[model samples]
Target: MDKKNLKDESILNHDDYKDQHGAVVPPLYQNSLFTFDSWDSIDQAFDHKTEAFIYSRILNPTVKVAEDKIAALCRGEKAKLCASGIAAITSAILHCVRAGDHIVTIKNIYGPTNKFINSYLKTKFNISSTFVDGRDVAEFENAIQENTTLIYLESPASLTMELQDLKAIAQLAQSRNIKTVIDNTWASPIFQKPLTMGIDIEVHSASKYLGGHSDVVAGVIISNKEILDSILMAEHELLGAKMAPFEGWLILRSLRTLPIRMRALMDNTMAVAKFLENDERVGKVNYPGLESFEQYDLGQNQMTGYGCLLSFELLTKDIEKIKQFVDSLQLFSLGVSWGGHDSLVYAPIISYLKELSPEQFDAMGINASLIRISVGLEHTDDLVADLHQALSRIA
Candidate 1:
């Protein structure tokens, strides 16, 4: 984390209003179950009509407090935590679909998400999905089938950082009586809230920016009570994806300074992106914050801040150069996930685009030398120097 963020961490205690004993931190309801005073009270608790806890699998004070805070922060009527981001995603999608239903989703989503919906859900539930370029509103409009139940989107469409016109798509979905679901992990609610813009459901990989430390792996769904309750049955209970009390506490701890942390990280990202862009070896930079980004204007309209995750391509297709570039990085560790205090690097996606024709590959907006980066809370100069030094080895 940055020096300012580190110093500001203990300046504010977030638990004062929620704590009864002035403990200054929300107490962990670590037990699996809570006892009831009377038969009537037990029955009421069973029906979820009382504040009493029944089981940790169903409800717990520590988890509930985190849920409340996330809902308030994201401006949603209700929220539910889950064991992982895929849990939140799968549960939410199932909540909106059934056997023989169809969904239209953006082409470039998180890999696991694309596989889960296209492979798992398709085989198990007879559900079908179409992947489209989300930048074209007409594409989403035309992909709708008679059985289409959902319009799924990932704005700044994950890898490509291609933004969709959320308000336009939401309007079309509402007119067609279809609901919208978005994986808002990239921008986070700190930068964007899809619900207020007319989207029906929003999911985040709390393991990312929400946790901010890379130690916790969790996810959350934010929406109205009706949708949340439906998923609570269809996905949460049946699928057994409840968020544990300790996990909830971890996320709650990170939630206190998400705004400040994100701001600092954004600074780091913009600097690194700009540095890479000015280098002759850099082919393309996929970051909404960059003025050269194709969807820069649209991203500005929908989001208050561009997130720290970015992707860029090199001018060469040589695998050896790719290895040299990645292996030479001093600070960025090679990892899969992002939105943490430590910078991470991932495999070059261009190797997988080999099957596509030149035109087709260009259409996808990625190439063989492309590297995805998640800028962390490092000093901007250090992060820039690291990339500059690595690129020099490739050159």
Candidate 2:
């Protein structure tokens, strides 16, 4: 178990833990704790001074493999895996903000993130927050306070697909001496690299794309070495929200095929987005890939690829007709998460409205009949036929 004696430190490696059978994939280390050869070794691990993983709660060989691959994907100094996407996000926010700290964030990020900041932190901690339109750098500048410690953002902001200029925002946050964090889950580090733009930190809901099979629910934080260490101490070790070894194994398998899966997913997405845009029944398809999108140029400037998620409101606002359309779909599954081989559809009016205030809803134009689709690896022709039939149901 000596680090200096290792031959290769590839993403597929589990340090030097060689199986007697010479297996290609590392064997899952499912036990809760590891035995020490001597009393000094145990002391070294507990002291936060040793790289040796002593407990599954803190670290495991299988989980470490996934973490290493994620870190490499993000081009980060380090990475930490968590139980769920919220675990990764909440931990990063809580770790960065102490009581009385202020946060300025984009209006439409992931719903759970909005709830965590507006509801949970507002009630328990004295952290203050201001939500703004991130598409305008001036809004971010205007929202900053003397106490502002963090600036959080999500580009192609959740369902609405509003684009943010990451490089400009990062520069603004840097000049203000404020920390910058972003949810890069939508682009999956395949199409966008936030860290390279001078952003301080990036996070992902590994449950969606990283797992790629709709099986494991996991999260990750990719950032500088110092910030990761701080989060590891506060949220990871103290809260005991580490990913299970078995789940880690599944994610590793998914990571191996991520590149190919993402290529096919994007191709399907482009095809589907075009089909939705051209349809007479569809209104305001919110995909950056389309030249008709308001921020299409901005998205093209920052993102290397058009991602797999898009939302559109029906020309008809009847809720009953919308339900019929959703229920009639064959290829796309009705579910919450995506990045699997199977496509998914969800109504934000059903879940997202519960979190937004009446005034916010009015300002944002919360279309009751809107539909969001997470494109998958399905053949484009078949997926289009499934969607066309669903639209026919509504008519």
Candidate 3:
């Protein structure tokens, strides 16, 4: 139990803890509810006097391990797990911004997140939001109002991959006395730690790279102990958006291989971006790792490494040509999500921000022919060949 010599692995690594049966892997505590020995013990647990699982909806040991691991990775005082990435996003936002409060968000975030903030939250909770190009610090400052409660952002902002100055924005939020939250899905904690940059809350769709296999859907939120304790009290306790025990165990297993998987992915991705950058059929490439990227310097300042996500545009806006390119791919799977052992691809025209228009896209530097590619652990040559054939067909 020595903190100094804990196998030189992260606390989330299952190797850090042996199961009750002394099994190397932690056994899944799959039971939905826990039993108490007596009425007094049950009452004590209900009162939060002792650490005992009363119900699966509120707390579970397996999920707790996952939460602790994520919290430690983000250098957060505490963490909580949710059923899905959207759950993490919603829980993180709702836990702070209540009815009548206002929020300011980036324009080109994930589609469902935008829907949730623009339509759902407004209808259900009467909360309002102003969507702005998050890359512009002046816009974020201008959007802040007296009632602005939350400032939400997705750095390397979803399809366009624009990098925002985290320190400047956090300082702006602090000056205005507003809460700041970031969707850390694109750049995982290994790449960027928003908490370290003075952000209040960080959320991730662990369903992506954190799971690394695309088999499980999970989400996590890490925050300072104060905000985390509040989320634990309200979101964790009352609303009960707890992650399933089995999913938590899967996440723990995935965490062990995350660093290895991400390295392979990002390396392959950088190569792919470079390949497409030279392709005459390609209109543009959006990747932070690329030296030609407008925000490359800022990205380097904020992230430990450029991540596996990359998007590129074709010279043609023909949707059929786009479909042809996707269909010609043999190595990369035509899938919705990324960050798996297998590479994935999707057309930004179809899958990215739903509200984005041609003018908006042009303004944001995203073209109609854009394709979002998530590189995987496949052989670099094979991926390049696939891209070559795919692009040839479009040509």
The prediction achieving the highest lDDT against the true structure is 1
Clashes of each: 2, 0, 0
Which consecutive 10 residues in model 1 have the weakest lDDT in total?
Answer: 3-12
TM-score of 1: 0.93
Model 3, 23-115: lDDT tens digits are 877779998999999999998897872245888877788878777777777888788888888888988898779898999998888888989
Alpha-carbon runs more than 4 Å astray in model 3: 1-9, 14-16, 49-51, 351-365
What is the lDDT for 365 in model 2?
66
Question: Is 1 or 3 the stronger prediction by lDDT?
Answer: 1
Q: How would you encode candidate 1's per-residue C-alpha lDDT over 1-395 as one tens digit per residue?
A: 43223222332234435566777788888899888889998888767732347878767788888887777667787888899998999888888998999999988888788888899989999999999988889999999999999988888766779899999999999999999999999998878989989999999999999999999999999999888877875678778899989999898888888889889988889889999889897988899999999888898999989888999887878878888899999999987889999999886454454545656755766676778999999898888889989988988
Q: After superposition, how far is residue 198 of candidate 3 from its true place, in Å?
A: 0.8
Mark the 10 consecutive residues where model 3 has the least summed lDDT.
3-12
Question: Cα RMSD (Å) per model?
Answer: 4.5, 3.5, 2.4
Model 2 Cα lDDT, one tens digit per residue, 1-395: 55433321244344344578988787898999999988898888788732468888878888887787777677787888899988999988887788888999987888889989988898899899999878899999999999999999888776888888999999999999999999988887777889989998898889988888888899989998899888887778899888999999898888877766777888899899999999998888998888899998888888888668889988887768888899999999999987788899998877756766655665766677779999988789999999999998887
In model 2, the clashing pairs are: none
- Every candidate's lDDT: 0.85, 0.84, 0.84
